[model samples]
Target: MNPARALIVDLPGPDLTLEEGRFLARHSFGGVCLFARNITTPERTARLVRDLRDALGHDALVATDQEGGAVLRRLDVPHPPTPMGLGALRDPEAAREAGAVAARGLLDLGINWNFAPSLDVNVNPGNPVIGERSFGSDPALVAELGVAWALGSEAAGVMSAVKHFPGHGDTQVDSHLDLPTVNKSREALEACEWLPFRAAVRAGVGSVMTAHILYPALDGERPATLSPAVLTGLLRGEWGYDGVVVTDAMDMRAIADRYPGGVGAPLTLTAGADAVLVCGHGELTPHAEHLNAVERALRDGTLAEDRLQEALTRLASAARRFPGTPRPYTAAERERDGAQVRAWARASVTRVGQVPRLSPDAEVLLLTPDQPGVGGPYGDSLGGDELAATLRAYFPRLRHANYSPTDARAARALLDEFPGAPALLATPTRWNLTPVQKELAGLLPARGGIHLALWNPEHARALPLPALVSYGFRPAHLAAVAQALITGEAPGVLPLAAPEVV
Candidate 1:
């Protein structure tokens, strides 16, 4: 097989430039993955995909990480709640609806493949990366919901890849910055990490994306992305998964920082990954180096020609399944698609502790931490102004304040000024808050108000009070929190036990 068919590259911008076009035309890249940077508008996104295909001379698979919630790349659209939120509803149908909505939106943007339905069982609450992104901590629940998502996307004619294979949910380190190790023995992995993957494979998932993590008990030296023991011996030989094996973004620090240019890409492919995904905001020249390395490996007999051919075959099969013509939708159809997302949001609210009864005439103080952006981790940061505006819809007599925990004066003033009024504090889940932020979050419980965690189910445990967790902080998540606050009702249950409960 041509080694070029084993690589997937990314564009530098929303529009295809001359250099990018030339590079794309010269290489038989198996796919091209899009990001938020490549999407200026729906029209521009569709145009870019078409342009990439035109340059490549064939319909290459176009993929995106439109997993909804915090990982949503498409902006200005209604996104379903995070997978953890869906798991909280204890309804696989909600998971399917979320997947279908994501598929419809991705298809509208000319994307054929979705890197979604993360099969990782979020067994560790401290995992910074996979927090609310996972379906839930229970392997059975994750498997059930993950399969529903994969089938839902497939129903929309979009190829689905259950990701971060072998589980990325037990480590605290983010693979984007560095490699994380899962020390579980083979038996432990089979019992926990491998459960969802097995179910996904049984459900006929089209692709499996290898995690950029090390399992010391499996292959002590190499990460799963480059370990033949993990990829070939276990995933293929033991599990009998004949579907495509795609590596996580080779540009990520776990690979790029560990192995020099062109090293990780070829190593991953040689390790049994059918496709090496190189996605980032850097130069495209590295992609050429990766392709060249694959070519050299094939010629030198370092990488078997048959293995390369097998990958090409898988890519061809995936392309055949998604012919790359995204069916257009009417405004009404788009609205209907968005309505499902909204419905999931409504049923995905989880409340902890006792629901406080507030007097209609009493003033409610909304406390949000001072952050740099408009929202916090996983999405646009909710600036002090926007946070207040969003909460005002639910609490009409609301007064907003932003405090930096580091400033003693600000903390003292914030604590003193809001004594009489009931306060609701917005906290981040994945954020390991500073001492000051922790102090502020801890102080909120004593002040007699609800602790609203905006990121994951575990954030409230950091507080000294009972908290309401939203699994996400997107518009839908925030809206759900607001609705629950206004109506004093929470329909969803916590997917994972809160830190206090444990």
Candidate 2:
């Protein structure tokens, strides 16, 4: 075959265009990674994928970042608990079940590849990008739960790409905008960041997605995706991982800012990346240009033929390994998953210290951050709408305001108008605390205030007790926080150590 599926491109929307079909045929693309916009419903997504494959006239992978909680492509459907929530549950069997269920849904949508089960150990409280995606801070726990999740996914025939390999959890910078540096010594990396990945490989994860982070200890200059030392030497040579290695989105500033004109495609292939991901809807380079650039690299010997064939082999082997048995998630499965998620919220949300109840007759103000648009990467970060809808049931007079740093002064003034009314500040993310979240929680009067850390328990300590760490902002999790604030009855314990639970 003259064409080898070496590239993974994204679609512009749910329906593939004629130009898109032509592009797929021209280059023999390996796969398409669908975003939220491409997924409206299971029926529509399945049709779109079928049409895509008919155009190619070849087998191709369909993927999405369907990791539960924060990054779900199918938002309309019920999902199991996030990795952090599952980590709190500490039941590897439960983690495996979540993975199996997610895989089934993905297969129903005609998706076979899932970029998920982040093996990153989130030890840094300041990591902006990977707060709740990780299973937990402890490497051992992350390894156990992550492997269980991955094994479950693979067993169900949907391959899991355990990601941001060589770790993206310890950095402060978001790779979407810039490259982050992880300054840990090799020894420290071995102890923390590398453990879960090692475990994933040992447990036979099908794929690994390389991080866009720079580890100076591994390679002095280049980021992991472009560094042979990290990808080829460490991952392939040392760890004996012969599976496919997919680079994270090439459009991200971490890669794009450094390599212009789609030159990174050849560089990544040279470095051991199997798939060159140039995402649609936000790609910088023209489609033809990326293909042209790779062709030129080949002509110039920058990309060796053997290297190209080797990468293709790995990608092909993955499809053969996890040829899924596709089945739609039944209505019963949806309700079952919904109940499991609700149970998780009930069992994992932590109440710190004595949470004071607000009088039903008193005025109450809830400050929250806004959720990103449905297609954005952090779409579910702030489920403020979900939280407010639930909280309104408890406090009839409750007024909710989406606040930014500019609204800090107004939020404080709004609190003063109520005199003795309690003001509640809720943050669904830890490292991602918006400026307004920090300022308003600080501005609230020490006595008549409630702070809810909806994602992590430690971040709740930023304010005072009388706070609840709900561990998530899903409808069920936020409902528990709403119930706890009004009745002082949060029952879930923190996955991590925390202060007294009310």
Candidate 3:
């Protein structure tokens, strides 16, 4: 039987060391999942994947979380910003095209598998982890767009893994912090949460990743990751999902905190997961310990060897179906991809509120959140530089500022610079609105109109502003917003459940 082993390795940056690559190969890991930290340039990333395949042989799965929008892992390389931006287009055709573009980009980077096209329906607008990463609020729309993306990605020769099965969209708490429980009945879950995943499976998605959330309707005491009723019974039996079922990061608080005897990986596989992604272990020591534990379980007959072979066979079959090829993009192909990125970037713009026409020569102020210079728990490089570059291209006379505590001081400074300039708050969603920003939103009617560009809408919802606009944090959105404000054009209308706020 194939070895009961899988690996989760972090790329230092842009490429992997020969030693690191060889280590993974010698260990015979099932796969490696890439994060933003592993990417730098397209060429370098492609070379890294090539080296990994060469070292690990053709059977290894090279995967990335290239879901687009908020969950996008590669930004140093050229690609559109987020998934919500594409969802805002509300056109399945557009979503398909974007998926094709993303697939081509991933293949160019030497990645054969994508942990993307998040099937989680964004039911809770305030969900901390899934905000702009989700397609939209409606389950039907999310399923349509997500299925289109899966089909497009597969067509482009990359296997797609639909994620957070049993839904991670409705919870307010992030599973990264602790286990989140979904108290909805099976009927309610089937109607709202399970629809998108069911649609994805019907579309022939290659894989499904289990969520860490607990569903009382499925299993009262265990999270979905450890619940056979949820994974094997519900997903595999009831829904007829025969594809490989993988667990989300096993190191997440939900699994690590609750697992008995720390046998999370063994328990996960026993519960019907084909693979366990143990991310954020930091060093090889912890990873080696966990892998050893799993191996021991197999030896002791605690983890059935048949289950391990089944998982390895599915993983190998998938690798063969989507075989590795070094299709390094040429200059012409790169240029074409660049153009598509720009177009999708434009399509993602969502104008949540009306903005009155401003004079062509009117000065505009741009304010962005003060992201840490070095990335910490949330990952580094929050796209602040990219936002600034996009803004400068659109607004030639734009003035900019990083977020600060002294809102009165900052606002006064901007007022001093351009006495009549209109202010536009262009920021990634933060935990809460600054008092200055909040006061400014309230004062917009008395002064001039304030336009808010939400990189993440969950952050935007924190402030109750009437004239708020949302851009899924794509460069094209910035350009489109700037043009719409300069000219007398109505931005694309937000789909409203309630009456229009006019």
Candidate 4:
């Protein structure tokens, strides 16, 4: 019963440290998960992954969150638009191509497991975390796009993990911060949240990531991550998901705040999760302490040995599916992927109301905020820089005012200064915005000539203003929104129900 071989751990830096290598060898850990801190260049990342595998003395599942939207790991890669952006394009095939591109990038970095294709049906409009990261509000669209991605990634020789199941899309709380509870009945879940997972399983997804949310209808006490009813009974027995079940990061507050040290590891595995993801941001506890807990559980007959073997078998089987060597990519392939991504961006930017055509001499007031540098549904590196530059290109007399969303005084002063001047207000709706930013969004249109540019379209219903929902914060998306605003031509049809305000 090698519990270490069933655990997936994270590195603290770009290079494979001797300590990490010794830990991997000592415990026979299943894999190493990478982050931005561990990825500097493709060449370096490939070497680091190879080094880690060498230390394990066996092929391990090298994984990373290569989900292209805001949850990007490799900074140099051409980050594709978000899942919602692809949904807006109404082309699942484009999603497949995007998945292939994302897979190729991962494979090039010697990463095998692509923890992506989030199958969560974003049913709740106010969901803080899984809003725009979801494909759309519709379950059918989410399933179609998710299955396409899984198949496409498989084709690229990279394993795909359709994530956060039973579903994390309905809750207002981020499981990273706290454990959220879902009150939906089994029938409700089947019609909405369960649809995508069922579809992905049928499509032969290599893995399913467990959510940290609790559902009283399923397991009243345990979260899905540690619930046999959800993990074994429902996912395996009912849905027949024979693939690997991964925990959403063990270090997250949802799991950590409740279960200390390695307590959650054996519990989740016993609950039917095949692999536990103990990915610390930088600092990781000693693997011996965690491995000892697992060893103790098996020794005391608390965790079944057969269950541990089953997990190891599944992990090894998934690792074997990936190519032994990372395939090389050419300039042509990169260019082709970039072109497809740009085309998708152009098709996905949804516009609402008439964007007043600004003359070169028109005084344009640009109200932009600082970029949300964090990852997830809310923020990415790609922010107002491209939009500001693009807007300035069109409007020669553009004036810039950068303020925090919470700055009411600044917002009032700016509104007073540029009253009725055609203003381009770029605001992020979902997270990190202050009360002033949210308030300013509602207050801007009444001041006139305010064309609201939503960074996150989920907030569209909340803000009753004529707006342009760009779907994402990429530079390509900025260009697409600019085109829609200038030409009044957007091919995107809302994949979900259009907001009544729009």
**C-alpha TM-scores of all predictions:** 0.95, 0.91, 0.90, 0.94
Candidate 2 minimal-lDDT segment of 10 residues: 371-380
Which is the leading candidate under TM-score?
Answer: 1
Please say which candidate is ahead in TM-score: 2 or 4.
4
- Per-residue lDDT for 464-491 in model 4, tens only? 5567777776667777776676677677
Mind sharing the TM-score for model 4?
A: 0.94
Best-to-worst TM-score order: 1, 4, 2, 3
Q: Pick the candidate with the highest lDDT.
A: 1
Model 2 TM-score relative to the real fold: 0.91
lDDT of 2 by residue, 212-237 (tens): 99999999899999999998999999
List lDDT for all candidates, in order: 0.80, 0.78, 0.70, 0.79
Question: Mind sharing the TM-score for model 3?
Answer: 0.90
Q: Which whole-number lDDT from 0 to 100 does residue 5 have in model 1?
A: 78
Error of 2 at 57 (Å): 3.9
Cα deviation at 211, candidate 4, in Å, is: 0.4
